[model samples]
Target: MEATSGMPRPELLQVADAVAREKGIDRDEVLGAMEQAIQKAGRSRYGHEHDIRAHIDRKTGEIKLARFIEVTDDIENDFTQMSLEQARIRDENINLGEFLIDPLPPIDFGRIAAQTAKQVIVQKVRDAERERQFEEYKDRTDEVINGVVKRVEFGNVLVDIGRAEAILRREELIPRETVRQGDRVRALILDVRREQRGPQIFLSRTHPTFMAKLFAQEVPEIYDGIIEIKSVARDPGSRAKISVLSSDSSIDPVGACVGMRGSRVQAVVAELQGEKIDIIQWSEDPATFVVNALAPAEVTKVVLDEETNRIEVVVPDDQLSLAIGRRGQNVRLASQLTGWDIDILTEEDESERRQEEARKRAEMFIKALDVDEVIAHLLVAEGFTSIEEVGYVPLAELAEIEGFEEEIAEELRNRARTFLSEEAERLQKRREELKVADDLVEFNGLSLAVVVRLGENDVKTLEDFADLASDELIEYIGDADNMTMDQANDLIMEARRKLGWFEGLEDETDETSEDAVEGEEA
Candidate 1:
């Protein structure tokens, strides 16, 4: 057999260099791909069953093609492996793990072989380009990128961001923003994922962080760290709200974000395709922050429920519609900005609710303590909401109310305790009649009312309760009870513990089976 020349192919090395530079890949990888093409052609000339391998010199692009037969102690496949005794016959120093190399002659370039080689080289170069793109874009998530619109297909914009392409889906684009081909587009890199086809870089123009970054670029105070963006919410091409806080006491964060004569905000708005921007001052106090978030509408007062993170904002009658915005946009953005649920109310509505609550509290005190309306009204007016407060509050606190002495306070407290004791007895009887599970009754933080409601919902057994999700429990009880998802999870977990539903019995079963097998073996 004739041997191929071992001389360096300088033209081949030059081609490898050019392809590597064009594809933004390593030159050695390209040379390795070329060697693979040559090795495939060599295999066609030699036997296909032989263990053929290929390598290319990195500096000179000289291809070496050979067939390898590995020496083994117990040879199973003769095509790739040879026994140690057989290998020793060829070379006395041959080891069991070493390979016996056999050089093969190069192949003549046929039409089909050259086409197959070209295809292999092209595929390898394409794979390298994809790997390069994935590595380059995966770290760029959550960053702003500028690209040109390459084309539009089915409302999805394909952008050419210099080296690689990114996709901006229709839903990710700002509303009503026309992106024509060749137009410069700026968007936030929402995600970079390596899929089966290649790397997919998802871009978004409507994400809240995009607006925040735009402000960071536009406002010197924000960019310099004098002002920080606390939160941002957008209605896309319509309106957006950004809450900013100033670290320096003298700098007005809202004014700084707005810039001189609205220049800074207008630039962001123009980029967003005429999206109206509301620059709000941020506050640690959620109520104050919410008031600022719902701009162009005045709030009369704010009542915050710290336990549930809800804020009730009362505005004048005329400002109600404005506070809620068109279709509740104002209140919705305010809720998002402050990270709290907001309930907007008119001043008259709030006044009516207060009066009704006061009446109910006065009535409750009158019935529980056997007091007249005047005395009950006095207790209710002093912020005593329930018999529990009357029974547990210090005697001095009750006496501090107008027209109340120590003797009267002591009598009221005694009556409140008696009433609560009777109520507990009644509830205990009701629970017994309902056949509430003993385990549920004993579960800490599971109130009597909750157990009764659970019974009514057919969740009578611990097993039944354990089968329920947190939201299911909330649905059975009610959100008015102020039951949080965490509390519901705790209650359900307690029920599960009582039922031994998560005792890892399956794991124990596996261990027991293994032990049985070992005992038999012994």
Candidate 2:
């Protein structure tokens, strides 16, 4: 970041240092970023006369700027850069890396010039701060930060952190939790991006760590070195699954986080707008950990696939919905937190899965009406995940099997061919209908082609405009001639509404009424 004044003021140095320390950056880094800002402004304003080279003194609180003429052999014939032999005439001590300060007095710099320099410094400092925040929060990635709700945007949320402000995009936010001005809310910093629009402070209450951080803050063992949080998966405002590790053998991380009367964790739950939190002890053993992560519901069996870090859990029939949570939120959060792809199944589903396996196995051995479970499972283990793959196995190989016959193998192959063809067609049709948009294609003049394409995409009801972010619409029309991205995005937004897209979606209730309902409920 830039120093506020030309000569480093004591207060300016202190502020820069504080910002650097809190953000975990070096003083030189901030200074370098500030100098770059001055250079850019100077180059833009003065072109070849961009002679100002600025530096901030580390030892002494002072800023110094110098103008230098480069040195080479020919000083008279060439003045752009100095020749080494001619430069030696001024000072025998001069070197390539060093430059001499111009002989101008400090009194020569005007008030207007000083003000320009100050403005440049402020801009650079803010830019550097933004870059620093992005770097710090980037590695933190999906973790959550708690802050007071500042305000609402057009479906966006503004949160006030102690040192920074963050924007929680509508899509990144959890669906259920209500936010209001002045409410202290917790959100996951989804992304921290540097853009001309500003440092895009991406935040989300939907992320899994909101609960994890809350527990860490609430639970003493976690705050101390006795316990470490391993992973967290949350559905936000509904339920969450957290895995914790204990460093001290004597202490139970899970129970410790829950507290004596559940008061500690309950406080976190209330702040989450009444979401449920499940704390489980994490394990290095996949089978055990997967089993624990899916608790509250009994896991009958857990089959872990080591290669893919995936797990297929079979829960009792009664606990299926509980294990899955509402709208598959439980498993989704767990999958995200644990970095595991979990396939949860009820006992009935497992039975059906097994039956499906058996059917495929029987298809492989058409000559024989039935095969033992051991043989069927063996066939599955032998890269035969489906009957179609088994058909690819050589008939000579099939004949070598104890139960196989050439005629039966031939029949199996024919059936596999038929099944595969039908399945491929279904998959192709599904993929086509799934909708892959290269974003909304923009056009100059908002012509007929763009309008027609929009209609074909089922976007006629202006509601579809919401799907296109401001940037994408602008990019399309930017190549159309004279339009800017900002102008295009705004035009599309307004045009979509004018085109009646807003009429399709439900009218949003007034904020006052919603707040009253929320207050009464609380």
Residue-level lDDT of model 2, residues 1-522, one tens digit each, is 122335445764676687578755677776676555555444444454535565656655465545556655445534246767766787798876455445322223356655765676666667666776666666776666778888988778888876678888887666665678998877777777778866777877666666666677788888786899888777666777788899889988888888889988889887777778888889998878877777777899988876557789999989989988878887787777668899988889899988786676655544332445555655655556555566577877765656657786676566667666765665445434544232333423454334444444465434465566666554443433344555556766675666567764535545667888999999
lDDT of 1 by residue, 319-434 (tens): 99999999899889888888989999999999999999999989989888899999988887788888899998998988888888899999999999999999888778878888
> What is candidate 1's TM-score against the reference?
0.91
TM-score of each: 0.91, 0.50
lDDT of 2: 0.67
Which stretches in model 2 have alpha-carbon errors above 4 Å?
A: 1-70, 74-102, 105-118, 121-151, 158-160, 178-183, 186-204, 245-250, 281-288, 299-323, 330-522
lDDT of each: 0.87, 0.67
Roughly what TM-score does model 2 have, to 2 decimal places?
0.50
| Span of ten consecutive residues with least summed lDDT in model 1 | 1-10
